[model samples]
Target: MATNDYTAILNELKGEITNMVVSSASAYADAAKHDAQALLSDMDANLQTWTQQLATGEISAQDLAFLVKTQKDLMKMQALKQAGLSAIAVDKLKNDVINVITSTIIGKI
Candidate 1:
């Protein structure tokens, strides 16, 4: 194949990859919004009493460890949610890249 042909194929692949990136970004945004809302709701439901205790300075030293653990769990969940969203985007990106390469090769042949 000519160099120009190769360049054209690459350009086409770039366009396809750009579209995939946009779609993945949109999906990630939607999922992140949903997950964040759920996280907020869960926190509200689970932590109101804890929050009140801390606010009132009534939390015993014994309970402090439990509160710390609960907070660590919350942080872990947030990280996992972000990782999940990133994985989804990455998967979409990989699939799009593969499809683009396959099509370019087959079409050239």
Candidate 2:
């Protein structure tokens, strides 16, 4: 795989999130999918940069995860909130998304 390829990294990131959102049985699954994609898109630049760093050994998997978590502001789970999901559930989902990011990058590498 081309570690320098941002699009490839993005596609993998998106695929993981898409799978989670689509597999859910929630009534607001579509809205959740939209929200998730929006967050991912908003943070695409940072993700791409970090992915390259991980591939080049400039950052370890733990460092990548730390960076991903630092972007919690991007977790704006509007759909989940509107669907009455509690803060705990939303937080879990947020971490789930982060895990998706880190694991996907590691897998790609």
Candidate 3:
């Protein structure tokens, strides 16, 4: 093949790869946001249930113990969810997408 043909093919492949990487990054961001929101909703529901139980005086000593344990579990889950949404991996993926986009633009220039 000619040199120009080879270069064109390479350019096309690079553009395709860049689009795919950007789309994947967007998908990751969307999924992470959804997971974080779901966790928050779960926490809110748990709080409501706990509040109602307390208001009803249905919380005996054993119930209080269980509620404390549940609270700790929810706190741990919230921390994990937050970490997952803002983790190093997500940051790296974001950087990679940005780098790919920049490279593609510069390459075209």
TM-scores for the candidates: 0.66, 0.37, 0.57
Q: What local distance difference test score does each model get?
A: 0.81, 0.74, 0.72
What ranking of all candidate models by lDDT puts the best one first? Answer: 1, 2, 3
- Tell me the TM-score of model 3: 0.57
Model 1, 56-84: lDDT tens digits are 88997468669868877877979887998
Off by over 4 Å in 3: 61-109
Candidates 2 and 3: which is better by TM-score? 3
In model 3, which range of ten residues has the least summed lDDT? 100-109
lDDT of 2 by residue, 1-109 (tens): 7656768899878888877655543635566677778777868988999999999999999999998887764464554464575454566667888898888777766
Q: Residue 28 deviation, candidate 3, in Å?
A: 1.2
> Which candidate has the top score in lDDT?
1
Give the true-structure RMSD of model 1: 4.0
Candidate 2 TM-score versus the reference: 0.37
